[model samples]
Target: MKKIKTPISDEEISELQIGDKILLSGVMYTGRDAALPQLVELIKKGKTPINTNGIAIMHTAVSDAGIAPTTSNKEEIESTIPFLSENGVKIHIGKGMLNDETKKALNKNNSIFVITPPVAALLTNNVLEKECVAFENEGIEALYKLKVENIPGIVAIAHGKSI
Candidate 1:
């Protein structure tokens, strides 16, 4: 498996191909339906709370139950992919296929989509630290910052290619 650390460089992203397994380390962020839209709005208004450049974002919620991949193709989540990629989010972690438009956007922005295993226990063990970074009122659905090590995933989409 390939090993990656964030904020992942464009060079690092360029080398990835669909179906390559990866062990991701360093900081990642979490967001799903409730928090992702708010983040997009924050970016549009030039009020972004965190720098997105070359960072990874997982489509999931953090709770006592642990974290696992959420359906990224959901309307609210999929709709944000392009804008988020435009804003420098290089790696999107989740499961499921995205539309053609989203794939083109990722290629244009030098971003990629990764699919993690659905096992929550496996994911939780990789998380070294976690904190809610925004939209706390959304509770478990809030945007969160995570420090992780060796969180495993496979590259499902990169540079206009999908697996």
Candidate 2:
């Protein structure tokens, strides 16, 4: 397994390969489909709450109940992935296969996409803390900020390449 600390560098990302085991530590932002577009708009307006550069974006909105990787196949949100990449998102964590558009975006942007196993309870154990950061009215679909440790995943696609 490869252990990676966040604010991940290009060299670090380049070293990853499809199916490689990963244990990621540090901070990752959370957002589901509802908050994704808002985040993109925030970036466009130059008013984003946090710098996305070298950071991972996990697909999930949270509540006290905890989190599990959300479906990555949401057509509305998946289409905007490349835009997120252009704005500095480096890692995307979710479940399921990505569409062609998202694949192309990942390729063009040097980002890595990971697929977490469908073990919500196990996944939640990795999260040290989480808080709603934006779009609270969206409820579970609100944006969240999470501090995670030893979060396990597999590289489904890495730096424009995939298994």
| Candidate 1 C-alpha lDDT tens digits along 31-134 | 99999999999999999999999999999999988999999999999999999999999999999989999999999999999999999999999999999999
Where is model 2 poorest over a 10-residue stretch in terms of lDDT?
60-69
TM-score of each: 0.99, 0.94
Q: How well does candidate 1 score on lDDT at residue 40?
A: 99
Stretches > 4 Å off in candidate 1: none
Worst 10 residues of 1 by lDDT: 154-163
| lDDT, candidate 2, at 124 | 84
Residue-level lDDT of model 2, residues 14-121, one tens digit each, is 788888999989998888789999988988999998888899998876766678888887875687688888777888999878877788888788888998886777
Residue 79 miss distance in model 2 (angstroms): 1.6
